[model samples]
Target: MIHCARTDKGMVRTNNEDAFYLPEGEDKPLLFIVADGMGGHKSGEIASRMAVEEISSHINHSFLVRGSGNETMQIIKEAFYNANIKIYRTSLQREECSGMGTTATMALFKDGRVYIGHVGDSRAYILRDGCIRQLTRDHSLVWQLLEEGRLTLEEVRCHPMKNVITRALGVDENVDVDLVEHEYKKGDIFLLCSDGLTNMLEDKEIRDIILGAESVGAAADKLIEAANSCGGFDNITVEIILVD
Candidate 1:
């Protein structure tokens, strides 16, 4: 496996509120995560950083909880839930962080499959056979409208409410996490990113960049560069994981 990641504050954001976690070494069944935060002041950064730490810690300690992939899936869900509760509690304790919340998208690779636990709008994509397919559904107002057939894809892209996510971690005492599993294949590539990248670059453009790049690291750099070139209105983050 080969992986590379990059993040930038972008052209407009004063601070980068995006956080990601990628484990090192030859640890099979590794974990990868991307988080995008929203709140007042610098609370968004705090929320996203807390989420990454909490989730990564929980997953790392869950090694003793052994079971099949289905059982492992449950553990992954629990990690997200625990992370939510932790962040929510922190928000409650800090007046400045009171409505702080973040989007969490996590991918766990084990036993020839990738298990994803998601909330908010950060996304996961799988590239196989020279094509890219989105894996997670956005929990945003625009996505809801698109699903209801009330808006066209073009409208969703430019909608004023595009950033209005319906669900996020730390928003409440509890959160609903969506989980899915994908069968991994050799040569398959996974891209995990915050909405900053997605909002700035179209899926086709992203696909083209990744396909044309010489390495995963190059692809991550190019994605961030492209997002900044387009506007970079938010903090941009990208993670590229290539199966060997």
Candidate 2:
């Protein structure tokens, strides 16, 4: 496995609310996480950091104890659920972070399989052969509109409420998480990123950069650079995992 990750505050945001986790070594499979926090006065940063740390710790301790297939999915779900509960409780204790929330996108690579747990609008994508496919759907109002056929891709781009996510961690006592798993093939490139990068570049643009890059590190850097080039209205973070 080859992997690399990058995060930038971009040009607009004074502070980077994005937080990510990429664990090292082989004690367990690679655990890649990306969180895009929402709130003011640095609350967003704290929310994302807490979610990543909580989820990473749970998965590190419990991953090997669980069986594969449905059991693995359950373990992953529980990890995120615990993270949500922790964040929500913390938010309740603080006035500044009262409604703090964040998007969580996690990817686990293990034994020829790929599992994804997603919430809010952060995304996971797989590039196999030359085609790019989004693995997780956005839990945003605009995404719901798109699903209902009430909005087009072009319309979503211009929609004022495109950033209004319908679901997020820490906002409520519980969150509905989307979990998925599939057999991974050699040469498959998996990407997990915050909406900052997605909002700045289209899927085709991301595909082109990944295909043109020489290494996973280069691909991640190029993606961040591209987003910054396009005004970089928000914090940007991306993780690239290549199955070798």
Candidate 3:
């Protein structure tokens, strides 16, 4: 497996609230994550960082034992649950961090399959045979409206409440995480990113950029550059994993 990741504060944001995790050593389990935080002041930054740290720690400690597919999915769920509780508790204990929350999207590769755990508007996608498909749904009001047929895809692009996410880690005492499993093939590319990238570029635009790049690292750099060129309004983050 080959992977690359990038994050930027964007052209407008004074501070970046996005956080991501990419495994360093080949000995480590294959895990990647992207988080976008929300709140006042620097709390959003703290929330996102905490989410990545807590989730990575949980998975690193618990993922060593091999298990069935269902068991692995359960492990991923537990990692999210544990991180939620930690972030939520921190929000309650620190007045400055009150109401702080973050979107968490993670991909864990195991036994030729990728397990995804998601919350908020961040997304996970798979590219195979020169085609791209979204693997997770956005947990936001506009997405809900779009699903209900009350809003069209074109409307979602400029909706006033497009940034209003309905579900996130640390906002409430409990968080509902979405889980998905996909079998990957050689040469397949998996992407996990924050809305900063998606909000600035359309799906087709993203697909083209990745397909056009010469390497995973270059693709990540291009994605961030493209988002910034499109008037980056928020922090941008991208993680790309190529199965070999």
TM-score of each: 0.97, 0.98, 0.98
Q: Which stretches of model 1 miss by more than 4 angstroms? A: 64-66
Query: Candidate 2 lDDT, tens digit per residue, 10-31?
Result: 9899999999999767776579
Order of the predicted models by TM-score, top scorer first: 3, 2, 1
Give the clashing pairs for model 3. Answer: none
Worst 10 residues of 1 by lDDT: 61-70
> 38-73 in candidate 1: lDDT tens per residue?
899899999999999988888887843346887888
> What local lDDT score does residue 16 receive in model 1, on the 0 to 100 scale?
93
Write one digit per residue (lDDT tens) for candidate 3, span 36-76. Answer: 99999799999999999998888887885578888888888
Task: Name the candidate, 2 or 3, with the larger TM-score value.
Answer: 3
Q: Report backbone clashes per prediction.
A: 0, 0, 0
Please give the CA lDDT of all the candidate structures.
0.92, 0.92, 0.94
